[model samples]
Target: MDHTAADDISHQANAWFALFHGGAPTPEQRAAWSAWMAADVRHAQAYAELENLWAASALLLQPSPAAAPVAPARLSRRRFVGLGLAASAAAVTAGAGTLWLNGVDSPFADLRTAVGERRIAYLPDGSTVEMAGHTAMNLDFSATRRAVELLHGQAFFRVRPSAAGEFSINTQAGRLHTREGEFCVSCENDAGLVAVSQGRVQVLTAGQQTELEEGLSLSFSARATGDIQRAELAQMLAWRNGRLVFFNEPLLTVVDALQRWRKGRIFIMDKQLAARRVSLILNLDHPDQMLDVLSRALAVRTTRYTDLVTLIYPA
Candidate 1:
């Protein structure tokens, strides 16, 4: 292939790499990418080259020994552009480190779901857990205890009645213990919310213990806990039905919830806009259209820099 042709193929491969790494692509996007890959053998080659470049760039970021500082490598125009794109991808991944179990990879999770995906896990002890998108957790079961550490994101758990011991969920905010119950727990921003729908839950935080009964919910952080409120189960567990119900919630809160069900990142450029309260019901079946609907409802402007980044600002 000619120089120009090869550069064009490389650029196309970079675009595909960005889209796939940005978040979980929709079925249509995946199909289109597959078709592109199959159309020409050169396409596959270009993609492989991009992957190799990225791997090398990652190695460059590591600290070197004290022997000597190596000279920087010179770059051609095409290589420079490829490296720039790789850097942006790296930045996005780093920015989302907290969401991915505080920099821990999903491969280390015993149970996990990708962006825009939900999963139901049936445990060895007959308990079941419904995991939300981008959620990760680790399970440790023994004869003396049934323990689960929620690394991040959210989950709805149904604990099976067992004489083995109390089922416990540990999170950054606190710990919850119960023998048998149905409840939802969401961990975000170094805090957590626990809503019980059945049975009872005992929450331990900051050297204090609080018990919650059915229909009650509590929010806790590393330092303190919020007042227990009557949980609106239908609204709290709406994600289970493929829906999001926000009632007078801040725009920031709504954005955070939407981020779980979709790929890419959404930023509110204005603090005023982020603090604005809104109420709406959105269906998760069409996550791509959510930002448009939200912008239209709130009279805001939404701009898409790429398939991976979006900015929301005042109209």
Candidate 2:
């Protein structure tokens, strides 16, 4: 109602939220909280407001290693960033407080396609997002944060960085900061891949960060650390140009690329066949045709089921 009342409510709400993160409260503290809950309707309202703040602030709340209360002076920078997000969330919740206290709609919220679907999206910030096959993501941009939540499948991002802002790809593992790069992110629930084709990018997980430059790749798994490996530039990036270039590349890797382009699967009967290096350019448009060309070029026999699946074996 009044400024003092609002400030008090905000302070109490923040305190309670801090307790929630600090760990389970003592029975005495719990009794106090319960008594406070019944003290007045405004107390309940303020507590609910604080819970909204916590949800809006989830992005900032990294788990403390010791599970202890984080002092105000020791609050991480991420918490400060979360403060801005919390304000934004506050704005959205002012009217429809009943609704989840979240930021505006995701950029990829409306992005989808049918089976064997593909669409290209040009973001407002001049970056281009190519949704490969059946992919989805939500795009959210504000003064402080530029982010996209990859819902499923794969998407290649040529991010146009803002001079004064940070662009991040938020997945289950954590946030990836793309400073300047042409990168591809393939996300399937808990496991994901972040490959940088050019420039540089940073992957943030838990409290750790990894910087990946051009020709570098990293795979992230939920509840575990990630592995950083050298990336083959041509094969990792060829999809952008509608071709997959394999210069003495392994057959297995080539088959994996074909799988992404089409719906079916490619099975190699001989494991030694995977060691054989084959140099060829496969057009993504017609995977079956590529198989036929491979068959001719490598003396391999390919058996086909539907247009979506194929198997390659030595002739």
Candidate 3:
């Protein structure tokens, strides 16, 4: 256990896993992998450390540790890749060096989720809120501004707009004004996206204003001066179906979307799966059925280590 070489191998293992989990390995990478495996058990041990680190991180992104678990089944390659990315991102943000155990107290006590989880709530204002996995929202509808803070993840709002009142959904980025109709807004960090499914929404910033009509969508990054990206009709409001709808979206992006509602993770075993195009209606209420359909459609296998964990690989 030489400190210098063990530490070096450990870092290299992390890098290798990053690339390996990222895509198909090159011939050289495959060959080097064999040599590394033969060199010593430490190389394998080091890689295991990285993998364990990532797996632990998936828990942090969950909406709540107490949330129900998804049924055990196989996951798709695309879902697997998606979980890897989510775990990596969480590891970086939550400080990979820290140790966290299950059922530990969390500051996000207000709301949380595992992976691929979903929850619904009845609002004080007679509206309904369906919170996506790994998402949080806080309500502080003050006299000046009716605000629903988008802390993280995503949420769909069916607002009962009052005639004498205006509803404003607030995120770290800014505030959204909602009138008599239904809308949904997702916020992450200093950026947020808004979609109007049935009514109109006026998004207000420091000095700019944009309005979305029914069946339209837009994205706003948390920058002092950021422009908005107009969203397509069906693409923007796809969540209404209790599925993460995508059309030609990157595998990485789609996984991120699905991770929002379930307890189990979706890990990609190979990179080739990432580039393949998939079109399926995901039923959040039936995650297992969704996985089964995905496995057959994509020619992959879903392995469940636990009700809360899953990995996708070539069958």
Model 3 scores a TM of 0.56
Model 1 clash pairs are none
Model 3: number of backbone collisions? 23
Whole-model lDDT per candidate: 0.77, 0.62, 0.60
Q: Between candidates 1 and 3, which one is better according to lDDT?
A: 1
Mark the regions of model 1 whose C-alpha exceeds 4 Å error after superposition: 1-105
lDDT for each residue of candidate 2 in 185-215, tens digit (9 for 90 to 100): 8765677788887889888776678899886
TM-score of 1: 0.68
Task: Give the Å error, residue 202, model 2.
Answer: 1.2
Residues 1-315, model 1: lDDT tens digits? 797787567557756765674457899999999999999999998777656644543343343465463333455667655744654554222223343322224678899888778889998789999998888899999777799999888999999988778999999899999999999999975699999989999999997899999978999988999999877665678788776766568887888888788776666777777788986666677776677667656789876654555667789
Task: Name the lDDT of candidate 2.
Answer: 0.62
Please tell me which model should have the higher TM-score, number 1 or number 3: 1
Worst 10 residues of 1 by lDDT: 94-103
Please state every model's RMSD to the true fold in angstroms: 18.8, 27.3, 18.7
Cα lDDT tens digits, model 3, 95-125, are 1111222312234545554445567877666
Candidate 3 accuracy as lDDT = 0.60
Off by over 4 Å in 3: 1-122, 142-145, 161-165, 205-208, 224-239, 269-272, 301-304, 307-309, 313-315
